[model samples]
Target chain A: MENEFSIEVRDLTKMFGGFTAVDHISFEVRHGEIFGFLGANGAGKTTAIRMLCGLSLPTSGKAEVAGYDVFRKPEMVKRNIGYMSQKFSLYQDLTVSENIYFYGGIYGLKRKVIFQKTEELLEKLDLKHARNTLIRDIPLGWKQKLAFSVAILHDPQIVFLDEPTGGVDPITRRQFWDLIYEAAKAGVTIFVTTHYMDEAEYCNRISIMVDGRIEALGPPAELKTRFQSQDMDEVFVKLARG
Target chain B: MRTIYFILFKEFRQIFRNKAMLPIIFVMPVIQLIILAYAADFEVKNLKLFWIDKDQSQLSRQLLSKFEGSPYFRLTQADMSREAAETAMERDEVDVVLEVPAGFERDFLAEKKTQIQLTANAIDGVKGGFASAYGQAVIRDFYGDFLEENAARLSWQPPSGGTINIASANWYNPEMDYKTYMVPGVLALLVTMIGAFLSSMNIVREKELGTIEQLNVTPLKKTHFIAGKLIPFWAIAIFELAFGLVIAKILYDIPMLGNLFLLFGLSAVYLLVVLGLGLFISTVTETQQQAMFISWFILVIFIFLSGLFTAIENMPPWAQQLTYINPIRYFIEILRSLLLKGSGWAELQQQFYILLGYAVLINGLAIWRYRKRS
Candidate 1:
């Protein structure tokens, strides 16, 4: 049963002082599933993702990531999961290859393995020329793609991406999703949080969080039908207003 | 271990790549050392003086000439009026005012003593004290010579047939070079200031750059991350200290009487205390700016309480008590005692032990706090 699901949550709650940031929410993500966590700003999407990534402890309830309990086995969970934060997290002072090597090294990859992976990743991203270039000098779209690559470079069971494509253009967002689809095809489960309804449509399944509670959860087509809407955008608007 | 190594490699790359970091680590400390050693001077010299001599007798003339011969005093005006000299002092023209009144020889012959006024401007108390002492010595010398030469003419008998002579010697610093006294203290400061500043700002810079969040979500051990961050800065600071010591030896000729191994050993432990304080500050602060602000505040206290500028014994009792907790004070004391006094480990074991305790306590708290937070 644990092998079938990548993430298991039952009544996961997080609070800061007197304010409840994440209410008791329960969900499960299957192996290789593209699960979109959609919500407006301050709707607790980021907080929920933080708990799944083992970056924050839940105030109450049981949660497990990549078959490891987040509370009891957070270190193990961290070992099995990869994360890309909303804010760009690569060392801007380091070169692209240096960034790749650094993340791979921390993830416990062998130096030879890191070297091999570096050549393969640079070729695949068509960034071989920019390998020696500083991250600050790189283009924004390329930087985002590079960040996502570094996050999953460890070959974690699940990859958590929090608003991985916030400020990119529509074409770049599509290009970013192409990378996500390629990873999903290779049997990597992606747990991503974003407010973009269009990106919600690309997910196999998504949960709409409203004020710390998951108001709707289903396939995008099913959600659109259930809300009597044309697309995820209309469904989100109707659900948010109610 | 490999994780720590990787992190260290990455940290070194970033540190070396940073444009401002190299100068901050290497060039700036040496610059500060040379500047501070030369400029933090305590010796005062060439005190300016004004004189008002009313008596035309050879006694008064000879008294005025005595001041003229001394190297310490610069007699700017010889025939200035009392009112004019007082005005000169008021206007910051002279550091001292020498006044010899009329009938000075008659009064001296009758009473064996006469008053000669030496007034010093007390704006700079140290300079004023030196000025007054130098002036009085000259006047006393003139009086002694006059009494000896004119003994038959005046028929005056000396109160004491014999006078006591005192001889003084400066032991460790034979030349009494203030540079020798200041070099070790400033070097200690150079090591502590730059090391603490860099370490304290390290983690917070990651926080500002959003890298800590990324690292937090990974399998990298907390202890490994801390060690990686600290080891590079620690090594760099030790290397910088060695460089400064070499410069001190060549440039200032500061003595290194104690064992080099012991000095380096103590310095290593002392750096841990400093770096740990920085790490603790980094963990608590939210931004690099806040961390830098707190580091500045702590550094100001460290420099002042370390007795780098003023002797700790001379501080108020309360401030003296504060030095008990200041790590920099113990460090500066250890450095000076080793380099200047040739103190052995047994003589300096107390300082070594206190620094060890501090290293353990501060690093423990910083590690515990960081682990608890994550």
Candidate 2:
């Protein structure tokens, strides 16, 4: 049987010593979909993302990422996914072009291809002038855009973005979403977690995790109608509080 | 291999871009080399001496003059009473006192035995002992002279030379220049410092910045990652050794008597041992501060027992046994033999094998501990 989903989980759980960080939860995301994983802080979203990305082992569960079993085929899962955390993902001291080259090279891209992709990326982002500037010297908005581009530079089947737009202005946040849409159109699956509820509505499907369990799941319009709320923000509040 | 090249390129860029790191890696070791070589000297000189000559005889004056003539002792005051000399010693103003009794010359003429009383301040016991030994040597020479004059006056003829002749010569550093003895050991220490600290700190810095989390998710192999990290600092350590050797040659006239390739070959193996140990420490630790503290703890223990400043032979049997496991000790021994004694590979084969075994063991363990995912 051919499984068409980019990610599939069933009764997935993660425990830290005696504490269960992620309780038994399951979900499926199709290829080329922007899946918004929303939760309060410490709601086990990051832990779930780690499990899917093959960075952490699930305590007792089954997860398939990019058509590979996360437990038995983690390296395969890793090779097919890209990861970018808000706290990291780029060498601060390296120039923009060097960072691109380094990450691309690590993904085993040829030097000629890396050069071509770098030129295309800098031009598309309108960052040609800052190509030689250190990432530390660039603006935070530009860094996020570059980080997202680098995460998808290998053209992996799935790209996991953990709060990739935190602390940016509303304009840059929307611009970052534009980049995400562009990537999804290119058939790259996006597993994004965010604190911004407005960003949650932009996802094709959304899951709200509360106390290590997914409290709500569906499209934004349906979730709003079901909760009798105006938007994802109110719907999220009702799920988290009630 | 290509993955490793990418990581290596990034590490080199980061290392060179940080303005403070390059200076710390290059300049600080050289400065420490010059200063510590001069400070770690063991040769004693310029001892202070005072005298009370109650005899006031020609013999007493002559003996005192002998002490004054030697470069090791400086005569400060003369003709003081024994009590005054004691006072100066208590005040830490004098190092030694020579008291000649009143009957010194008279007893000698009457063919009776005579003695001279020598007192020394024992606060710095080693220096005091050296000063007293020098004083005794001068007196023995004077006694020989006195007997010679007497023999001439009496026309006395001996059967043969009375004493058995003893000839002592120091080999391998005939002048015993302490700098010559210390430079190679210091160079070994410099190599160890750079290799251990830089590698450990580099890994932990990545951890602290949360960059490791990004790396952990990548498809990068653990062995490739470890090799990539080790190679950059390994190259830097070799560079540092070459730089320190040039400084050692120019500043101290240290002769590089053995084969350069042999020394460098062993050094490369020794660097792997140190860098591997450092990488192992980093894997067990989480923060740069924790890594630094652990590295410092082990490095301090290794350096003190390395026979760099002191002789390993003088240590207790168990401590000497402990040095066998110390890579720094083997490197220091290899360096000293090569630079000072011109020892060849056959003489240093044992150290080479031990270091090679340690390098393999440590690096294997380090690579095992480094997991791409937990």
Candidate 3:
């Protein structure tokens, strides 16, 4: 908490009715670090991310995002963080520039700022030619990339990507990581969730979630060595099964 | 504020892009206004009639000629027997049946009193009643004329020369054209439907597409987000209303006697209520299909109870009590009164206040129910 970590979760818990979805999970995402959260189906990765993003209330424990308390100052937390979900969360009927302007506007960016950001983002993504094209007509891989770009259009302190690369081709996945690297280079913390074990190797630090709790938290290399495995996949299998 | 604008812009883009919704929003109302206006006339026309003139005398023949000459009734058959007249009435071919008793002329000459029997279909009671009244009036006129002519022949005169005492005048729509009354009400119905139907699907669509989580993570306040989503549909609903009114005026010859600005202003306020209800529904429902189904169900009840097709006063007491809560009832009433009766603010202040309350209450409920956590 004393350090300049962008996100800090201390024994965070979230429950729906009588069922616990994210149970007493504690972790930290350092500034500018790419943290990978890996989990199987219903592994509570989404629930935990939701709590950290100020999108859901934790049943107990506490967390802070960009130095703002999750419960008492969730609005501040929301303002400093960006989020992209697996489903390509954007208005499909809207054009690329329209989506950027809309999301940027919601984040309280000035019109001139939104205009400037829209021009810069489209050029950076090489989407200038299709800026006016409806998102529904764009290729799926481009849509995902554009969605990622839109999420961080306001230059938030942290960007949360919930399985952002799901259903994308390997080449596009690689390109998507390049964008994440670029954002990380700019001192923006990247908190991402994925089922793709291979992606965990690219993170600065990685956590494995199983049955609503964090099973392992460390750099990819350290986690693999500690579990006596050759790769992160084997390490996850050992920890998730245990 | 900017976020809400973005939401609104996106919503408009989506509405324009969806081919099916555009027609449902804009075209359907105009078509309904045209078709229903033509079909929903309370003034019965082309009425088929059968008369039993038992005497077949010159005087009876003259009375039958009066029925033939009247525009209200098309004398389809002159049956000699009472049984044939009754059969024609029951078979639905004839809406009205007249029985001129055997000694009608004789009794009129002797005692100055005669009776005629008129039977009409009572299924559509209002239409049947109007037809019956028309038939009775025509017969009364014929009898009065007969008495005048008879008095001249006998060289004897009664007081007032057998002149009838009744004078009738129809209010609002003197010509009794259904289109003039129905078009305005339908405009209200259409505007409300667009607001409730389209807005109900707005947030649920994001939820179904799994983008609600993205919106949840935005820095936008809940109220701002909801406002952004609702305002565009509200504007579109108003636009649709305007278009419907234009069509009503141009195509159907609907009068615009009241201030157009007042109509639009009231429509804008009413649109907020409907759009707010739609957003509230979207927040509660999980799927677009559920939103649509629930909206349809609510709309059916609203339209039936809206006093668009029937007078609210004619409904049962308990049902009439429910009309006080229905926003459509007031809107339709205001629109019709203003458009047809040229009613001013003073005449419609009660309805205006009720609609204003509905607009505020519904939007507040929508904002309250839209939780940041869920």
Candidate 4:
């Protein structure tokens, strides 16, 4: 089952000059599992995600994303994965529909397929009326959710979300999580990094990274029991304190 | 190819939507062409002159009449004292001063010897030289008429049994309108200006907007990404070239003697070079402001050295050597030859190859410099 992991990492390490952002660590993200990567500010969560998403080369390590070597087959990895950054990167000047088309087009989806997927996704998100509206005019939460939908428009094997729910109202955040859950249930592996402790509880498995190393990794409930805490937040605080 | 088309469509839509950019891209060049065309005439229209007539005889009066009758010179004042004319020259009011020496008509009648003094302002050396040469030619013509009138008295006849006569003809652009010569070159510069300035910031702008990272994560190949960004600007540049040619034809009445197909073909190739150059700038520079500044610096130098404003032949030998690498120099030469000289492919093959080579070299360099990673 471990060999069936969608993402495999061995001794993954990234260093910037004298600073080590991601220490020599190993982890595996299971196929069809929602894995939460939790870290405080500057705990190297984004850097680690960047490596896993094949955006940056690791200083020293071997990692395979979507069965492609992150070093040699980055293009293959890119083709098989979707990524949404913390910035909710979408062209503000472009309409939401235009952004969908652009992203879908670049991903090699047929025009008809893109159109169909765009209509379906907009309808599902209840954003069909605002399809022609520029992304900047929409509220930030809607843009974040739309960005995530566009990222996975091609139905990649794994979707990487970097703090996808940051600075959003709780209701919008729950809606965003519903979208993530829907993708995960459809057998798309979800690897997300967030500082929100409650969001971490929603993941099937959670890893707490501190000082460039994973301090703990297990099922969220088991980790809470092992830490003798009522919830994942107290568990994370207890582990962090230790 | 589809990705490139999508990117190009988006870029075109954005450019059209931006009201400020629309005028800058479309209207400014036409306005500059008209204004510069009128302001840049080389034909010295109004020339100021003062004359000193010490002789006050028929010959002297006749010489002064030549100056006054000529459209090139305007007689501002006349004085018997050369000193007053000299003062006028010092004050910069008079461009040229002609002094008839105090020999009256006695010298010409008795000894057939006379000398005229001419003074010119030398501040603008070229204008001063033309004025002095014009004055000398007028004096020579006046003397020739006087000599012809007294030919029998002096027994003046050609020593040869027959006289030789020569006639010269100026070909296309007979009137030598400076605007005609400049319009084609200006059109070329305008295409280059649009390409270098507009396209250079394209990728840098994406990077600034953080869209580049989004693009990088997509399945789009680097070549596809570059082509997508390049194609729209290439089309815009070609359209600008066409628009410029239309203005050249309608407003300046510049004739297109060469094949329009050939002009478009060359313009397409030249625009590729410019687009490549712009992309190369975008890849190297980190900011849009830097891209613009660098493009401006390159364009100013290229335009100055392109022989549109100045003759490359008159430049120093070392400076002329630099023109070989200057793409605008070759483009201007090609445009002028095609439009004014009606040069065929055989005549323009050398420049064609140069532009083609530059297009490949710069584009290859730009692509090589561009990396998916930082």
Runs in model 4 with CA error above 4 Å? Answer: A1-3, A17-19, A220-242, B54-58, B77-93, B104-106, B109-112, B150-168
Best by TM-score: 2
Which numbered prediction scores highest in lDDT against the true structure? Answer: 2
lDDT of 3 by residue, B85-192 (tens): 777777787888888888887876666667888888777788699789888888888867776777766556667834658666868888767889888888888888
Cα miss at B58, model 2 (Å)? 2.6
Please identify model 1 stretches exceeding 4 Å from their true place.
B61-65, B68-71, B105-111, B144-161, B371-374
lDDT of 3 at B229: 83
Model 1 chain B: which ten-residue window has the lowest total lDDT?
B159-168
Binned by DockQ into CAPRI classes (incorrect, acceptable, medium, high), candidate 2 is high
Candidate 4, CAPRI quality class derived from DockQ: medium
Over 4 Å off, model 3: B21-26, B101-115, B154-156, B161-164
Question: How do the predictions measure up, each by TM-score?
Answer: 0.95, 0.97, 0.94, 0.92
lDDT of 4 by residue, B48-136 (tens): 98988888888888888898888789999988887788888899889998888778578886746678888888888878988988888
Q: What DockQ does each listed candidate score? A: 0.71, 0.81, 0.72, 0.59
The residue-level lDDT of candidate 4 at B296 comes to 89
Instruction: Rank the models by lDDT, top first.
Output: 2, 1, 4, 3
User: Candidate 1: what's its TM-score on chain B?
Assistant: 0.91
lDDT of 2 by residue, B228-250 (tens): 99999999999899999988988
**How many backbone clashes can be found in candidate 2?**
0
Name the lDDT of candidate 4. Answer: 0.86
Candidate 2 per-residue lDDT, tens place, A99-189, comes to 9999998888999999999999999999999999999999999999999999999999999999999998999999999999999999999
- lDDT score, residue B354, model 3? 85
Compared with the true structure, model 3 gives a TM-score of: 0.94
